[model samples]
Target: MAEAEFARPIVTVDIVLLTLHEGRLCVALLERSAQPFLGVPALIGGYLHTDEDADAEAAVRRILKAKAGLEGIFFEQLGTFASARRDPRDWSVSIAYFALVPQGALKGAANPLELRPVEAAGELPFDHQEIVTAALARLRGKGAYSTIPARLLPEVFTMSELQAIYETVMGERLDQSAFRRKVNDLDLLEVVEGEKRQTERARRPTTLYRLKTPVAVFDRRI
Candidate 1:
């Protein structure tokens, strides 16, 4: 006897490409070029290609490289959003991924992205707003105690700059001494010997540091 079949849902990956610009957390969006929502801004996403993609991650990498011209950027799976009503075309399943990148990286990409402050991304189509909210929650939750926040900075940055990024992600001020102590205790950074840079906060040369690992998690919050 033959088994009953279920309807296949539309599988895709949506990227929440976030960055800090002018001290504000922003997300990248693109104008829909096709029908149903043509000319309207939406999150960068694409349908999964079974013949070409090895998996969802491959699809995401392909989409980002194709649409945003981005490569070797850090991103993690935020969550899955599957529902019958999210898309007008069909039942949709979106494997959402999020990344925090430096502003300069966007500038260097061959295809520049349209960015909007997270709070102002504004009434996006398809369940994108929900996906964005989830991504932000994950970032804020992991950002408090890990080197994850440093992903927003350049390859190497001053301690002040790292603290500023943390404050930005956490949406509050952090004590300079305390923050420095926490960072040192985590041992997540390595000082760049003979390297110093001037920041807007001061004209004096400041110590530069780089993450020892891509990311690290602590049992406690900073």
Candidate 2:
């Protein structure tokens, strides 16, 4: 093989950070600080620091922390993008990742970080809109049979709040009875003792609950 053909491609990491805001799904984006799309909205990303980062995951963690002021978020590798024209600089490949964080966690993040509704997000630089779309699809698909969406909620939540989070991701209204029954059967939640929440519409305080286990993958879709 020709040496030119074997030249290593530039590698980068991009993260689609998602959180729920005002009952809508939102994604965190950063405005590019340098050229090659200067001042344009883009996913939080950077070239992999081979000397410092131990792996792709480590690179993503560093990128999120530096760009979004986020750490210890629940993230998973969504996929990779290697389109020849994706990057204007050179032949590059980006290992894409998606993270879920509770909105409360981002209370004091740094400036230039914007959280826009996923559906209303305008054109993003370098196929980033496509990446966010793929991430949302993965999240919704996984929500059906897994406990992934629970990560978007606080440590303690009411069943109604849990159901609302699922509904927000699924983009549909679920049958309350059926939803509760399915959740109960999964054995994933534990009731919080003597804890309840009262909303303006509710005459009584609703019991609070939390996940009994971190992750749950159901054998059948609920």
Candidate 3:
């Protein structure tokens, strides 16, 4: 095989940081600081440090903290995007990841990243729109049968608030009675004793609960 046929691959990591803003699902996009697409909004990404990053996950953590000023958020590898034309420089491979954070988490973010609705984060650079689409599919697909959607909620919340995040991810209204029953059946929450919030029904205060685990998978869809 010709040596030129196997060009050195330009490796990088890109993250899709998601959160709920204004009751809508949104993603964080950083304005590129360098020339490939200077000043353009794109996914949070950077070159993989061969000497520094212990692994791709390590690279993701480093990039998220360095580029987006984010850390300790729940993240998972989505997949890899590699193509000769994906980058103008050379053959490349992007180790893509996605993360979920609560809406209030970014209130103090000092980075240049801005939230854009998943439906309207248009024309991102370097096949990023495709990466976003795949990440969204994974989120909504896993969300229907797991507690993944709860990651978008604050540390403490009412059942209504939790259900609202689920509805936002699923893009449909769920039956309140059935949804609560499923939540109970899954044993996903533990009551925040002595904490309650006033709801539409002023006579009775709604109870608040916190997730019992990071993610709980149920057999049936929500």
Candidate 4:
């Protein structure tokens, strides 16, 4: 193997932070503060600090906090993107990750973070649109038959709210009765005592529940 072939590539961590906003699936984007694409909307990302970051996840966490003012959100490694022409600055590779959080959690800092509908976020820099598409596919695929959709809800929520989050991510409507039955069978949630809330459309207060555990598992029925 040639030494040149083994040369280290410029590595960066890019995050696709997703949330439910105004009844739509939204992705968080940060306007680039420096060049290659100055002032252009891009995924929250930065060069991985070799000495400072212990791993790619650590680098992602630091970048999210620094760029998006986000922390403690549900995130997972989506994939890796590498193309010689991906970055105009150099030959670069990016470790891509996706996170899900409730819109309420992002309230104060969303000013700097542009929350665009996933379908409408066009032409992001450095293969980012491709990255976002991958993340969306992962979310929708896992959402069916997994507890992944719970990450987009508040700690306490009614079954209707849960269904709404699922539908929003899946980009389709689910039969309410069937959805409730499936959720009950999964046993992923536990009812919260003395916690109930009613939406404007509800005739009565609905029972609230929270996840029994954070880890999501697949269910064959879904």
Candidate No. with top lDDT? 3
Q: Each prediction's Cα lDDT score? A: 0.87, 0.87, 0.89, 0.86
- For model 4, the local distance difference test gives 0.86
TM agreement with the true structure for every prediction: 0.94, 0.93, 0.93, 0.93
Candidate 4 lowest-lDDT run of ten: 103-112
Candidate 1: tens digits of C-alpha lDDT, residues 53-172: 999999888988888778888899999999999999999899999977787777644445788888678899999999998888899999997888899998989888888889888889
Off by over 4 Å in 3: 1-6, 108-110, 199-202
Per-residue CA lDDT of model 4 for 1-222, tens digit only, reads 998888777899898999988888999888887888899999988899989999999998887777667788889999989978999977899999999988767764644788899988888988999999999999888888688888988788888888888888888988999888887887778999987888888899888899999856864644
Angstrom error at residue 13, model 2: 0.9
Q: How far off is residue 11 in model 4, in Å?
A: 0.3
Q: Tell me the lDDT of model 1 at 58.
A: 94
> Per-residue CA lDDT of candidate 2, range 137-216, in tens?
99989988998898999889988889999988889999999999999898889999988899776899989899888778
The alpha-carbon deviation from the true structure for residue 194 of candidate 1, after best TM-score superposition, in angstroms, is 1.8
> Positional deviation of 59 in candidate 3, in angstroms?
1.0
2 against 4, candidate with superior lDDT: 2
Report the C-alpha displacement of residue 51, candidate 2, in angstroms.
1.4
Candidate 3's TM-score? 0.93
